[model samples]
Structures are given as structure tokens and as C-alpha cells.
Target: MHRCLKIPEILLTIFQNFPSTTYFLEAKCLVSLACTCRDFHAPALDLLWYTLEDLVPLLRIMPDDLVRGKLDPSFWRQWSFSRPLVPSGFERFDYYAPRVKVLTRLSISIDSLTLQDLLQLSSLAKLTDLRMILPDDDMTLPDVQALDHDGVAVLPALLDLHVVSSKLANCTALIQCLHRCTLESINLTLQNPPSGRSLGELFMVLSQSACRASLQSLMISAHDELSHSDEDIVYSTVLAPLLLLRSLYIVVIDNSNWPGLDGKSLQQMVLAWPRLCYLHLYTFELGTTHHSLVTLEGLLPLAAHCPNLCTINLGLHASFKMTESLPGRGVINRNVKLLDFGHSTIDIDAVPHVAGFLSDVFPCANIISTWDEDEFEEDEEDEEIAMSTAWDEVISLHPVFVIARHQERFAY
Candidate 1:
């Protein structure tokens, strides 16, 4: 690199040209740039410290006494603090700590995180987004009580948190800590959730968060089905107060028992949370098989009111005969360009009508639904083709239906 290229602005522009996933070179390039000159130091350093994937960089800055654990200094990058160790120097958190404001993603085993480690992570002053993962061998139950101790609590300003394969007790502590932190989003994935009774208590804790009003996105998923007889708790009655919420995802992998909404209640949600831009609901139960649980009639309130809604994913009871339409509601959503029905099942009988209705509302949008080769019944395949033809026909000024070709990338 030339001296002129070391101008902070020029360097930033050049570095930013690399994709955000340019993780392969982000650390090396930014660190090298920071060492070049005093002028390039702050900008390059800012970029380098903006995301701390691990504690190795910080380990390099620590006083020798702090790391008395006979481990190699370089070994800290892959080290796990399983033993009861509290290095008393959080106040000594380095100069670059404040620059970390985005996803402070740390891949670690929950069992390996001692009180000291958890407290250390909580003390990331500027952390807004964080994701913690449990390694494959971490079968030990988590200690939730310690997570809630005043000695180690989350500070306000942290917004997004995601915990995968963690215990319900751990999740409870994290949610209860919301009162301390002004969090907006929470995502949890449990391979095995607790009993329905305990699960309800966990949800109640979240619904009653001190910062519930500030919450905007909440995603609770599980590999196993979470069946609740009291489905009302998962609906608008509990979440309606989050008027600022923009995205909501409730997915139960291959489980049909997840809670759902009817036309009236769904309408109420659309009215209550006008800011909702994304709403995804997944379940194995086929609404198309049973016509009453969910109906196309629900689309009335959505198309009429939700102007900011850009994406929707809900199972619908498709019918061959189109439902009655609103006579005078001319409202059209401009921002909603994607409609996903990944969890929705299309009725073989009503493919054309469903296509026509979807096209009528989102004329320029792309539609996504479940697509499987082996599971495709002959009747459904022909209907799907017919639906696509209907969609393409209405997309253009002319009646000619042209299929769009799309190439999807599978890997990062």
C-alpha cells in the first residue's frame, strides 16, 4: 500500500469493498493498516476492534499476572474457562473494547463458561448483538441462578441476543436480565425444551420483562414440538403491547402443534402492531386440510392495514372458490416485496384461486412456498404449474406468462 492510500478515508473505502463475510482477511488487513502510521491508526483500529470473535486479541494486551493460568498466551484463542477462575481485571478491559457494538458472536460450550467468563462477556460495554453456542459435548445442565446474580448482570443498551442449545433455566435468567438491559430482540433454540408448565413460566417471564415495551423482535424455536393447550399465551394478547416490534418468528421444526392465529386475532395483530415488517409462523398442521383454523379471509386486514409489512409467512386454508373481497379498500402495500409460505401448504383444488389472490395483492412480489420433489402428488404438481402460469400472466401488462429464472447460492 502507498502512503497516499493510507489516508483513513481511502483505506476505509478500499477495505469495505470486501464482503462483510471477508472474515478470512478482516483481522490481518485491519491490524496491518493500523500499524502503518499515526494517521491511519484510529480508523484501522476501529475497523479491527469493531467485532471481537474471541478473547485472543484482548489476551495479548493483559498484564502477565492476569493470565497466571500456565496456558500458552497463544492458546487463549481456543481456551475454555471451565475451572472456577476469576481474573480480577475487568476494569482493565482494553481501549478497543468500546468499538465492539455489533454481533459479538462467541462459539463456546455453555458448560465451559464459568462465572468469571459469563461476567466478562456481560461486561462488553458496547455489545449490542451477541450469540452464544453450546459445543457438541456440553451435556451438563446450566446454572441459571448464577446468571442472575448481581455480581454478573447484563447492562442496558445491549439489544439482540441469541442462545442456541442452552437450557430453559439459562434462558430464563437471560430474559429476567432484560430489566437490567434495554434489549429489543431475543432468539433461543432449545433441542429439548422443558415441560409445558415450565415452558409457560419461561414465556411469562419474557412477556413480563421490564423492557418488554422496547422489544421489537422475538424468535423462539425448537427442534422438538412445543405443544401448549393454552395457545392464547403465545398470541397477541401477550405480545400486543410490543407496538414497536417489527419481526416475529415462532418455528417448531416438523411439529404441527405450535400455537397459531385465526383470522380475527390475526387482524387484531395487524392493527395492534402497525410496525410489523416480518411475521413468520411454522407448523406441521395443514390448514388447507382443515378449512377453519386459518382462512384466506385473514388477508383482508393485512392487505388493508399493514403498509410497512414487507414479508409474511403464515399457513392458510386454501379454497377453490375465492372468498368475498373488501368492496372499497384500495390500500396497497408498496414495501412488501416478499411473501413466504414455506410453512404453508397449498390446496390442490385451489391453486389458481390462491395464485390470483396473491397476485392481486402483491403484484410485483416474489412468492415462496414449500417445494419438494418426492412429496409432489400429481394433482398438486399440475395445480402448481397452473398457479405459476396465473402468477406470470398477471405480472405484466400483457397476458403472456414468462417464467423467471433465478440462481441461488448455497454456501457462504
Candidate 2:
């Protein structure tokens, strides 16, 4: 082989160019290259095992007699051991497990081996990003307990954790497992709004654990109906502890109301993160009776602080009265490119004032708002239509104000 072909970077680039649109085809081509010579074996195998969407490929490495499931087509992606697992079955598993860096779409079945069994088999030393769907029905008390022992994380090197589930119980259990790892990003989507206790525990684990110092991005979304009790837990109480995470650059919370989120609370939250670049807090979906206590005035602090902030979305009640004496009158934030106020109501008469105010605060921001078509009632349709029209007017009128402000500044 030529000296250039021997270079690791050159070989990797060549392997990357191989067709990847088809998994089995790519695997076959890599397998052929691996068999061709000892030089190509290691790198070929590394790319093949770099990302495992599921554990099926790893389990396929075991001896045919040791594991079973070919009897039925339903269990194609799943398998169970025919007999008690022995160390010999893990020889091939041990070799390839260390190569995995990203694991996603992992599904745990109640009938199959538990997470504890997998963790015991290999530490997955190189696994850095893990996304799993933890079914509440498949998880057991012992399975979760297995991860809580000795303060040792199952995936110690994990940095980004993404959990999407309809239930909060299993999601909470999985998060508790990573207390020992300093995860940099956490994206959680739950169908049900977490109870105050669950939310407290979740925040507590992130704040008190190794994650507090290293966490940079957090995105939590609850897609179910909000109850009166759920409304009482203010966002500040559950999320304020995160202020210690000075490295936080992005924060997103959707359909979760912050009952007491006023100008003071907003100011405190925005000021806590100097590196904040994106702030998206959609407290209430459109057409809902619920509205944030914050008005357009609440956003003034964002202009003064958060220099790196570029994308902003907040639910605020915009009215002409507040616009008359808008806070941070002269303060400007040119970094902001788009301002999305979800389900926020705007008085028809206040469109011009709100537009000019936003232009002054976020001179470069493009204002937009959206409503949930499914949430509006027949009687409220007219009101929502009016609100949508008013916000549309603001969007149209904003650029004119932006130009006029620039001219005024130059004239000064």
C-alpha cells in the first residue's frame, strides 16, 4: 500500500466516502475491506460500530446457541437468552462495546435482558451521547435501583442525555442514574406535566449533582393538560437552582406556566447566565385563558444583560398602557434575530406601540406569534382571529420602526 493510503486520516476519509445510505450494504462493503488486510480491519470496524441505533447488532455477535429469538418474527429487533448468560457469550460483545460512542433509539423490553444486565456486561467506556425511550411498563424497581448503587454511573462518559416518554416516573429514574456524570445537555419531553415533587427532585438532582457545573443547555417540555396544583409551582422555584450553572447558554420550556414570572424574576433569571444565547419560555399555548404576568416591559433586562442572546421567545401580555412608559426605553439588543412570543395576547390598539417598543429593545428582531388551532373554542375564535391580526400587524410594522430608530440615532 502507498504511504498516503496508510495514513489514518486518509483511510478514514476514503471509508467515509463509501455509500452509507444503505446500512447493510455499507456493512458488507466494510466487512469486505476488513477481511482484505489487517491494515483496514481496525478502522473499518471502528466506523461500523461507532453508532448503534439499537443493541440488535451487538447481540448478533453472540453465539447462536447462547441467545434465541429467530423462532418468531415479532421479536426481530429483540432477543432473549436460551439459558443463563455466561462470560463466554460476552467475548465478542466486550470487543465491540468499547467502540460505541453514540447510542440512540434503545428500547428495553420487559421480557428481554434489563439495563443492569447490559451495564454489568460492559461499561460502554466510550459512550458519550445516549438517547433512550424508557417504557414505564418495562422498567421495574430493581432495574432503576441497579443504577443507584455505589454512586457509579452506568455511562460515566455520557455528555448529552435525551429522554422522550409519556410517563415521568421512568424518565425520573433514568435521570437519577446519571447523577455521577457531568452531563452538558439534557432534552426531556414528557406527555404529562410533572408533579411539583417530581419537578423538584428532577431539578434537585441536576443542581446538586455533578451536572450543575457542566450543564450548558436544558430543554424541558410537558405536552399534557395543566392542573391547578401544577400551576402553583413557579418556574423560579424549580429552576432557580440552575442559576449556579454559569455555563448555561440555551434554555427552553414549552407549555409550562411560570405563575410568578414577573419583571423581577425574569431579570434575575436573565442576569444569572452571562453566556445565554437562546431563551425560549412559552408559558401558555395560544387561545388559553392563562397569561403570563410579564408584559413587554419584562424583556428590558434581556437587552441590558445577555449580550450573546440571539433567539428569544416569551409569553407576555402586550397592551398600549404598558407601551406608553416602556421600561428600558433606550436600551437596545442588536444580536437578537427573531422574537417568538407564543400565545401572547396583544390589544389591537397597542400594535404600533408594541412594535416600536420591540424595535427599540431588539433592533434586529423579527417579531412573530402563533396560536394553537386545536385549543381555540368557537366563541373565542373571533377573539383569537383579532389577536392574530394584531400580532401580524406588529410583524409588518416592526421593520419601519427599526428604520426610523436607526435614522433617529444617526440624527442624534
Alpha-carbon local distance difference test for all models: 0.55, 0.74
Residue pairs clashing in model 1 are none
Across residues 1-412, which tens digit of lDDT does each residue of candidate 1 receive?
A: 5787757787777766755555757777777768987777888777777777555566555555555333322122244343354655544565767765553544343555555565676666666766666443434332555555555555445777777753556666546644467667777776653443445555577556655566667666666654435444444343344432333322222224334457776777776567677776655443333433566657667767777677777666545464476221344554667765543544555555665555555554666655444555675666545444443433342111112111111231
Best by the TM-score measure? 2
Residue-by-residue lDDT tens digits, candidate 2, 1-412 = 8888777677878998996778899988988887878778888888888888777888888998887654322222446888888898899999999888767534443322356655752366556676664554635433545556544466677788777666666666666666677889988877766566566677776777788888999987777767436655776676677677777899886655566667787788777888899998765443446666788878878878888999988888887455455434778889989898877888778888888888888878877787655656798888887888888889888899889978987999
Q: Residue 21 in candidate 2 has what lDDT? A: 75
- The TM-score values for the models, in the order shown, are 0.58, 0.73
Provide the clashing-pair count of each candidate structure: 0, 0
State the lDDT at 347 in candidate 1: 55
Indicate the residue-level lDDT of 217 in model 2. Answer: 95
